[model samples]
Target chain A: MADAEAKERRILVAVDEGEESMYALSWCLKNLICESSKDTLILLYVKPPRVVYTALDGTGYMFSSDIITTMEKYSNDVAGCVIEKAKTLCRDLQNVKVETKVEHGDPRDVICEMTGKLGADMLVMGSHGYGLIKRAFLGSVSNHCAQNASCPVLIVKRPKSTAGSN
Target chain B: MADAEAKERRILVAVDEGEESMYALSWCLKNLICESSKDTLILLYVKPPRVVYTALDGTGYMFSSDIITTMEKYSNDVAGCVIEKAKTLCRDLQNVKVETKVEHGDPRDVICEMTGKLGADMLVMGSHGYGLIKRAFLGSVSNHCAQNASCPVLIVKRPKSTAGSN
Candidate 1:
């Protein structure tokens, strides 16, 4: 069903194709309500920096052409997966609007920036995403987003043992 | 290491024996530094409900009791383990204050209660702590706390795949 109220309330779900994130997305679908209207679900995924730099005689070297191409391809593939999953979930919800967004750069910075532009009220996200290994080496997107986001964030916790359960 | 400048700052960590909880505790130890002579780490653990019930089978003869145990033995064990871990970690931090407390109730409620009663400025915790099976049955503590907390909360995101990687 289409209506004016359905277009308003916003619930942003940061997806990285992880169990916790999916659980959070599911939770949002089940709990969020706008008094008399349905809420909007936005699936957001931020692609990590693909430009790799090497130390060429102590000076930073530009990313190789092949690496850059591969990075773009990989980012597109991951983003596509997020959109697909969100679409499947949206099919089940009644009148709620579900949209997808993808961006590049720091996950926290991008989310904070987006929130400023889009007055979203709640951030639903899983604590661990597909980039867990990379995050452990550098940092975690969930941590940064929770710390920096202006709005309240729902961090769905998934236990290691339950990784494959969901 | 122990002087007048190390007595004012206090760090409160909600310990639950979940590795993710420890991650938040570690982050607090790394950050939330005190400029003066006071540094205290308070490890708080809230024990959730644990009771046993016995009932009679249908038909004519089997009778059983519906009495719940006074306390949950497993919960106590988890709290004890978390406290021990915190104590061991606190040994190396210089000019820091460390303590442990375990209470019974909902973790989010207990945390808020403790913070209010203690007048804590900041809170650090892992994003999720419920084990796989329990999480499926109940829910994650961090998500609940984020929605209901009155003060600032730092929810540390655990990596999805922290195995084999450093």
Candidate 2:
């Protein structure tokens, strides 16, 4: 009965270097989680795959070892940086389990797939709130996740005045 | 200071004649709202515009009075039924205000526009949880709202077993 009372909820929060995503992290801390709730936050960062420039015949020179090493360093730095930020934001919440994951793929596909794989009760992410014309043409990550995720998706949008302050 | 503390949160919930949406309403009541929170639920029903058959020359045929009346009655019935269902779900929660509005337009456009106009702090709706292929081809209403709404959007998805049970 004590174990059942501690029903741990898995919450997946997609994070990026963008302030909107960080603001979403903050908002989730403030509004969604409460003292009595047993929650686990999975902070996920999806890095775009390395794009290789190819010649017309589809044959491309292999990247030099130095360049490959530098790219790997950059990728590691970014993943570490974003996850650290998310961790700092959740530092105040005692007893909540936090985990970080980094995946390389299209964010839309990765976010939805990870949510199901992690058995996330809810997926939370930030919306950049692109205007209708821009959103229609460019599409958005949050929109795709909302459409595809198996669980509920909560999109947090910071108010306009405080939008970039994060 | 008291007035500021009592600032009511206008939550716009999009409803339809589907069990998925009603399940979303139930989830909202169970998870999002509380008695201490000043809350107003705006139940919106967007009726798809009546289709008219046009001739090759672009001259459209008009519906007879009986047909038009029948269509109007059907629309009204659906709107009333959905709103009533939402209200009944909230019956146990005392001191929460509920208002209903029925509009004629595409749901995507109407829901976003009304959220801005209503100054909604948040918008809550249900996702149909269509698989990737289906959602990719047939765009979803909740996805569009999450992308375009000025405020945050919480999409409540019922658990699989309990989804259609509601």
Candidate 3:
């Protein structure tokens, strides 16, 4: 038998509430981590900072009392849902360690920092398949992670024909 | 004996006249491909279109013939060097097929098109690792490929500590 602990590879995967990220997690589980590799899978979910706005600028408008609480609950629910999805994807793997984390910050910065801090061997992420203009308008998190991460990055995008499978 | 032909995988690698791309080729050889996999490595080098300069007043102040020839020769030399380097790295891998391609166009477009056309299982390339401002000013090939390639794309970057190794 191979020394299971001798070749443990640490893989960090960035997941979110998007189907593409979930597909990426599935791809990583199927292709990257082998049954004998004894790899550790760390799932990271970065929650964007919540911003509440009130029309207090001369309009004399105020938000309802339950608005903030509802927003908080919604964000928490989303984070929990994504984590549960990832957990379900990894449940069948044998001899592989799995962990999940939720952090509040920019996705790009948090992912890069966590990769460095965790000494991960590889960082896996999903591409949302945005066009050039859209990517420019909304800064690309996977692009930033690829350029800035301390470890190698694998950006997985679903094939065109398979887009409907998810 | 294993049936090598039955398990062949097509892997497309984007190479340029940069140390980082060469490092990516090395990393792919060490980490991704194995003799048992019987992978076919497609090395692609995209040459940018040559530019012809003209005076603002529409006057014919074109580059000298010798100067244009010299620039062409330099570009050709760089492309040849990169392909030769990639070939040498794969010289020892048994039962693996190696092919080289040189195309003229934008790097991002050519890579994505080639991957789709060739039905590549995976696309591997290196990151120049530009920071935010620089990436905004000059677009990144790896970033574009990550979002547009038809197959899974791996963007490999040399670690910060190994920056001086090349």
Q: Residue-wise lDDT of candidate 1 within B5-70, one digit each (tens)? A: 323544467887567677666645543343233556688987764421111223554333332332
> What is the alpha-carbon lDDT for the whole of candidate 2?
0.73
Please give the lDDT score at residue B2 for candidate 1: 17
Can you list the residue pairs that collide in candidate 2? none
Model 2's CAPRI class is acceptable
* Stretches > 4 Å off in candidate 2: A1-8, A51-59, A128-139, A157-166, B1-9, B51-60, B128-139, B157-166
Better of 1 and 2 by DockQ: 2
Per-residue C-alpha lDDT of model 2 across residues B13-120, encoded as one tens digit per residue: 888887777777776666555455567888888775554211212446667788678878987897788788878887887767888888886677788899998888
Task: Write the residue-wise lDDT of candidate 3 on A21-130 in tens digits.
Answer: 88888888766666655678999887665421232224665656587677678878988999999999989887788989999765767889999998898888888622
Reference-based lDDT, each prediction: 0.61, 0.73, 0.76
Residue-by-residue lDDT tens digits, candidate 3, B68-158: 7886888788789878988998888776789999887667788899998998888899897223333344478787889888888999987
Alpha-carbon runs more than 4 Å astray in model 3 = A1-6, A52-66, A129-138, B1-8, B52-60, B63-70, B129-138
Report how far off residue A29 is in candidate 3 (Å). 2.3
What's the residue-level lDDT of B6 in candidate 3? 48
Give the candidate order by descending lDDT: 3, 2, 1
TM-score of chain B of 3: 0.83
- In model 3, the Cα lDDT at residue A40 comes to 88
